[model samples]
Target: MTNRLVTLFKFGIVGVANTTVDAVMFALLAVIGVPLLIAQVISYSCGVANSYWLNGRWTFRDAAREGNERAKLIRFLITNLVVLVLSAQILMSLHNMLGWSLVMSKTLTTLMGMVLNYMASRYWVFRLAIK
Candidate 1:
């Protein structure tokens, strides 16, 4: 139980780091006149890269090992892609239909997707180790 809590804490830290990367990149792209959709894709890609590195190196370090890294990366990408679509839909709905600011919409979407990302990564992406 204690170990699990510690792992969760680490995961949260890594998540925050990823979020920072995403927000910064998104803002930068937007400032430079990139389309909102393209900025989102670029930011999310940066976040995904950060997530894979931090989660594999720290959050799930105990399970990281040889022979499974490629599989793990693949699984992680698949899970992230799903979450990305969900997030994009939510953001678009809030921005287009509700008159919310893009930043606000994206922030809400990010928070909502965090749990889904964690669950899918833990249960599906990294399931091989536990089994």
Candidate 2:
């Protein structure tokens, strides 16, 4: 596979792991009486933390090291914060407004955010410096 494809494959793997973490946490929190919105934020935060650590060291390791470490972390946080807000909104709309199950709403929101998440991670947060 080409370099981009290889990187995408790795990102996909991390995304699965991240999704697992998010879903499990969300389910646990919800079952324990946490509000859906709060559960969504807390669970997604866990996934974001996992994503930063793994994706930095594994999926995007070959990305050009143009920026400082602090800057990279900040970018990653901002990108994820944007994604989280959108995901939360979508989840709420699907579950509350549209009368979907929580599981179905969460799954759809995650799928909807996946591509945009990957694109921002690759092109903005962990940008490769062109040779």
Best by lDDT: 2
Best candidate, TM-score:
1
lDDT per model vs. reference:
0.85, 0.87
Q: What is the alpha-carbon lDDT of model 1 when measured against the actual structure?
A: 0.85
What does the lDDT read for residue 14 in candidate 2? 99
Give the residue spans of candidate 2 off by over 4 A. 22-43
Q: Tens digit of lDDT per residue, candidate 1, span 29-94?
A: 999999999998899799889999998878877566533788889989989888878988999999
TM-score of each: 0.77, 0.75
Which pairs of residues clash in candidate 2, taking residues 3 or more apart in a chain or in different chains?
none
